[model samples]
Target: MIRLSMMMGRTAAWVACLVLGLGAAVQAGTVDVYSNNVGGDAVVGASPTVAIGSSGWYYSDVRVGGTAGIDSTFARSGNGSVLFQGDASAGSYKADVSYSTGESLGKLSDLSSFSYDWYRSAASTNNGIQAPSLRLLLGVDGVYKGALVFEPYYSLTTPGDVATDTWVHSNIFDPNMYLWSNKDLPFQEQFNHDIAFWKSEIGNYDILGVSSGIGSGWYGTSIAAVDNIHFGFGEGPGTTYNFEVGAVPEPASVVSFLIAGGFGLAGAAYRRRRAR
Candidate 1:
């Protein structure tokens, strides 16, 4: 009887450890920066529009004309993703969307990493490889400092090019990953540089927010979507955003759900072990 009791205690402890381990595996760094389910359908642009979405996020079709909004037809995670469609047949158009983070996003030199998942529809007719560009809004002393841009066309890393109808994860912060600052310059003159180089060149810079979309020259009515954005600052775990359609559980609620599930699993494990 003593040996059986000891075995049961050990089993329970092991089960508890397993549950805790599972919880630890869940990404604590991830944050739902923008989880609202607004603008699920495409909004055709008659003229350039700004601040087109709820929250601080805004959509712009400044280049030519196209559509921009949250889309439900395809998503990398959850039930939706921000979609951009550039018009080509009529004229060159770009679909750009941006989010103005209410708070200062820290300095450029402190930015440790930036990544996002993007999808290019097979129907898109951009250069066989062009998808979308990740733009980081920059400022200094509360003054605008144009955007720091990263486009797959200039990337030297593997999976550096866009593949239509498939979601591709792009980590622009990787060393040697090419990027350019479009401040006071034309796209042709904005030469590509690595993150380290940009940091030095930009001097004192503050990250204003993040923007991603398709266009400028992505002609042929190309379509693309972006989601799962992450920005790491100064060696920290960083912030992550998972765009979703419709209401999502608050962070606390999600934590409670996970804890409850873990406890339930532990109970089941305990019972099975005792039955033995």
Candidate 2:
């Protein structure tokens, strides 16, 4: 009788701990790219260093890194906006965001989808269009493998259009919205490009770049104002969440399940002993 009593007590305590932990440790998560509060003192692509959100980062390309900043005059949803100004000379600049898991670095493959909002006013002096782009880069242990490229709708054609100043939402994973640079076109391709690298054995990173001279046409001033960004994990109508720059996921969920299992086994043993 005492042994069963002790077991029941132990199980009750374990269940209590789990319930408390879940309430205390569970966090609302979201990967926010930029907002009204987030801005920088320097212009993106032209400046060597720029602010991503609250924690700022550096930017540099093969040619040179430019400036990136937040714009107060224009904003879609928030009071402020993030702006990237193109450099006079030709070059591409990229700013890498820091995201990781408990054991491994977070890669593009970790998330099912990512999206952002932006407005662009650009013109191409050269034959090709040098525009700002977002990418999911894949590499093996460190060596570069490939990237999933996303180009804005207005930037694809030769003659650049003046942005209506209204904000637009773009989901990079959606086949209709984004295009792959090295891979074959979406759906119709004999092979899937982005998926291949994303599922590869190596780790990958995410990069946001504002290019000057490059692809289809070279735009001297690809003046762009961007805001409201999100990276989704198993994201959909009900499963998505949002997190800031510094926040990280905790292991409370796993612990909760384990504790619940222990309680179940203890209760079963108590019932069987009582019957006997």
- Which candidate number has the best TM-score? 1
- Candidate 1 lDDT over 1-276, as tens digits, reads 455456556656665676665565445665333333454656566655555334566765545467777767677677777777777775777777777756667888888888888888888766876877888888877678688888776774465545778888888767667777776522434546777777887746888888888776555767788887778788688766666566556445665665566556656766786799
How much lDDT does candidate 1 score? Answer: 0.70
* Candidate with best lDDT: 1
TM-score of 2: 0.49
Model 2 spans > 4 angstroms off = 1-40, 43-65, 89-109, 122-131, 154-164, 181-217, 235-276
TM-scores of all predicted structures = 0.71, 0.49
**Clash statistics: count for each candidate:** 1, 22
